[model samples]
Target: MRTDVLHAVRLARLDLTLIGRNTTVLVNVLLLPLLMAWFLTESVGDVEIAGVDGRLFVLTGMPGLIPGFAVFVNLVNSFTARREELVLKRLRGGQPSAAAVLGGSALGALALYLGQVALVAVWAGRSGGLVPANVPLLLLAAVLGVVLFCLLAAAFSGITPNAELAQVTVLPVLLVMLLGAPIAFPADTLPGVLGTVSHLLPATPLVEIMRTAFLGGDHVSGDGAALSMAGQWLTALPSFAVLLIWIAVAGVLARWLFRWEPRRG
Candidate 1:
């Protein structure tokens, strides 16, 4: 047990070092999302939405966006690169279980994503008066976002033939996840059936959870109703269920589709 943990930790450290050395990955996974958040926050400056500051609303969406790029898009490329290089195959041949191997490879990305989230949270708190109403719920949403996106990345990588193809493959998922969620605007304003369907997207629940945690209300119930902290926690239950379901679905797909070696030409 201890050996497995140690192996996973070592793999995570190595992956983090590699991520630091890769300029493109660092830029895409770390810099781009933060910049996007900053830009959006500034654009929405001092505006109010459903009684919550617009900047806070934008900041709450970072958990959704950060993991999408940091873990999902980045790991798809990471897994593809490692597979083509036979790194994944070599690791699989060793004592670490498949879960440990994949989890360790993904841990670094999760750490980076969390760091970006922290930066956004601190910035929002200081500048936008975004004090989270339910800190635990906020953390839960972030954790769930990381796990689901990591699994989705692993599953998606199975269909990605090469590192170059990863850039193209990630776009559709990003579009669906980001656009389908309440990022740039509130989900309740998305119009009729589209609004209803948006709630089903994997990113939606995570963002909803964060909004409830930070704003004490959600885009769905947009009448400026400030939920008590306990009420906010209760409101997050449905989103929690949605995230858990997606996590299970992603886990199944990853187990069935993830490839340790590159496909034969």
Candidate 2:
């Protein structure tokens, strides 16, 4: 047990070092999200959406976007690259357990994701007057978002043929996770069928959970009636359940489909 933890930590450190050396990956994983949040916040200005400040609305969505890119997109590329290089195969034959190998590879990305979330939270609090109405719920959403996206990344990596193909394969899931959520508009504002589909997207629950945590139930409930923080948490249960279901599905897919070696023609 202790050995697994140590191995995972060592692997995480190595991954972090590799990320630091790669300027493009570092920028995309760490800097791009901050810039996006800044630009989106600026564009929205002080307008209100669903009775919540637009800047706050955009800021709250960072939990969804950061993890989507840093964990899901980045991990698909990482896993695919390693598989193609035979690194995954070698590791599978070595001392590190599968859990340690996968968890360690994901830890570095998770760390970066968390750091970006903190930076956004601090910026939002100081500049956008975004105060958390429920800190526990906020933390829960962030953790679940990271775990769910990590599993999704692992599952998707199995389908990606190479690092280059990861870029193309990640787009559909990325678009759905980002645009399908209430990032640019309120959840209730999405049109008919689009609204129903958006609610089912993986990132939607995470965004909804964050928005509810930072704003309140009325902001997400769309009824114009304010809900107690407890009520807001209650309303978020469905979103939480959605995340759990995705996690389970992704876990099963990843276990079944993940390849340690590159595919042969």
Q: CA RMSD for every model?
A: 1.6, 1.8
List runs of model 2 lying over 4 Å from the truth. 216-219, 223-229
Cα lDDT of model 1 by residue, 88-178, tens digit:
9998998997778887866777778778877877887898677767888887788788889989999999999999899998999888876
Clashing pairs in 2: none
Give the distance in Å from residue 223's predicted Cα in candidate 1 to where it truly belongs. Answer: 4.0
lDDT per residue for candidate 2 within 1-265, as digits (tens), equals: 7887888899889988898899988887788778888888889988987766778878887777778788887788899999999999998899898998988977777787777777877887898676677889888888788878878888888988789889899899877766787786767778899988988888888887887787666545554356797898888888899889988988898888888899887
As a whole number from 0 to 100, the lDDT of residue 13 in candidate 1 is 88
Model 1: pairs clashing at backbone N, Cα or C within 3 Å: none
Per-model TM against the reference: 0.94, 0.93
Among the numbered candidates, top lDDT falls to 1
Please report the TM-score between candidate 1 and the true structure: 0.94
